[model samples]
Target: MSPFDPFVHVIDHPLVQHKLTLMRQKTASTTSFRTLLNELAMLMAYEVTRDMPTQEIQIDTPLETMTGRVIDGKKLALVSILRAGTGILDGFLSVVPGARVGHIGLYRDPTTLQAVEYYFKMPKEMEVRDVVVVDPMLATGHSAIAAITRIKATRPKSIKFVCLLTCPEGVKALREAHPDVHIFTAAIDRQLNSHGYILPGLGDAGDRIFGTQ
Candidate 1:
């Protein structure tokens, strides 16, 4: 894809859009926000796993035996990128209950505005499984990029990125950094402000979800 073209999936289903509108409002309460985030995460997960492989097997019904299809190979890996990512983890897990959970804790360096990894843990035999990395915001793309970069070292069968909101700049940054990774987002805002926050976007997701700010 060209620099101007990023492989991004924007979930625009009516229900998703409606919940996203609620999420973008400043007056939305933490309880409501958390609930909406979870709902949206589950919806987005549906789109992300659309291409998952499935295999056919024989099954027995009360009346007769029949063929059935089930998810193929190893279970998917759900890796949350720290505090904010955890917000979406539960939602994602709701849909993929059998998915393996992992966490990569990264904090931004105030001075450099770069991501610094604090902790990283993942499921065993990562190379044999598909991975979906979750984070609520892709503002600067630094944390997502850093987290994905580290995850790539494990050589998974495939990898995809998921977020609640992102801007054009962030999409371009991440696409350029990891061209092979597909991105799925609920909405794409206009741009990031001077402070690295999406304009007309919901404020700090971690703080909002945890009622810390």
Candidate 2:
């Protein structure tokens, strides 16, 4: 994937697009929003894990012996950025129940709009595992950049980012900051509003998920 184009994968599967349309509606209920987010996250996981390493092994079927392929890399580490990330985490875990999980608590600073890290914990031996960072929105890209920068410090074998929605500005910011990381999203919305919220986004994902606001 060239930095010129950025390795951003936009999921256009009909189900994904249809769910995203539901998510963007201002009238979507909190329960419905949460459900759609989880469904979309599970769909996105299929694409994210598309390139995972695999190895073939001989297996005995009920009728005959056969060779089959199974995922062959280190157990994946699903790193959730915070409260909203947990929503995606639920779906990702359903797809990879054996994978480990980590959490990084970073909230956007109201004044500077920069990421402020408060909590971080990850599985051991990061250098041997592939990590996928999960968050619902890549609004300003500051949180993704900051989270990956921290994860990169641990020298993981590779890293990828997944989100439900993003914008061109957010994509450009993340690509410029971390060219090595690939981004996967359901849709790239129009732009960020003045207050840094994604245009036509599903509103505050955490609040929608948890009914906080």
Candidate 3:
């Protein structure tokens, strides 16, 4: 297996690209947007979890016995970064059916431009599980860095970060704060807008996906 670098996997699979093309269009409906995001997340999970450890198990066929596959050692737990992260969770759950779930909610402190958590619930044995914290957009990555810091407090054996879209600032932030993590995304946009949104980003993922905007 390859040693994980500052891992960043951009899903360029054909199906994902086809769906993303539609997603990036100006007229894509909110319904399609949400659906695509979910679908893309599931597809991304396949690659993101490709390196998950596995074990051999004995299985009996209708007529014969054979060895089968089972997950090795540790199980996975997903930490949704709240609001938009919940959106990614739904899709991740579809693919990672057996993974445990955690939720961390942080509201940005307007004055400090930092994230302050108001809610956090994680697996009791988080240190024994492979944890992945997810969010849809990584504009400034301050929120992600905070979320990761809090999760690390639980001492998980390992942590991976996933996002749908990201900008350079966000990527840099995560790299600086948590270089041990693996990051997966559909695309990393060129830059952040004046107000901190990713340029050409689909807009507030929570708002667009939930029809709040």
Q: Give the alpha carbon lDDT tens digit for every residue of 66-174 in model 2.
A: 9999984347999999979999999998888888898999999988889999999999998888999999999999999999999999899999999999999899899
Error of 2 at 75 (Å): 2.1
lDDT of 2: 0.91
- The runs of at least 3 residues in candidate 2 whose Cα sits more than 4 Å from the true structure, single-residue gaps closed, are 1-6, 72-74
lDDT of 1 by residue, 8-49 (tens): 888889999999999889899999999999999988888999
Clashing residue pairs in candidate 1 are none
CA lDDT, every model vs. true structure: 0.90, 0.91, 0.84
Worst 10 residues of 2 by lDDT: 1-10
TM-score of 1: 0.95
- By lDDT rank, best first, the candidates go 2, 1, 3
Model 3 clashing residue pairs (backbone): none
Tell me the tens digit of each residue's lDDT in model 3 across 31-132.
998999899889888888888888888999999999988773338999998888987898988987889999999876766667888999997888789998
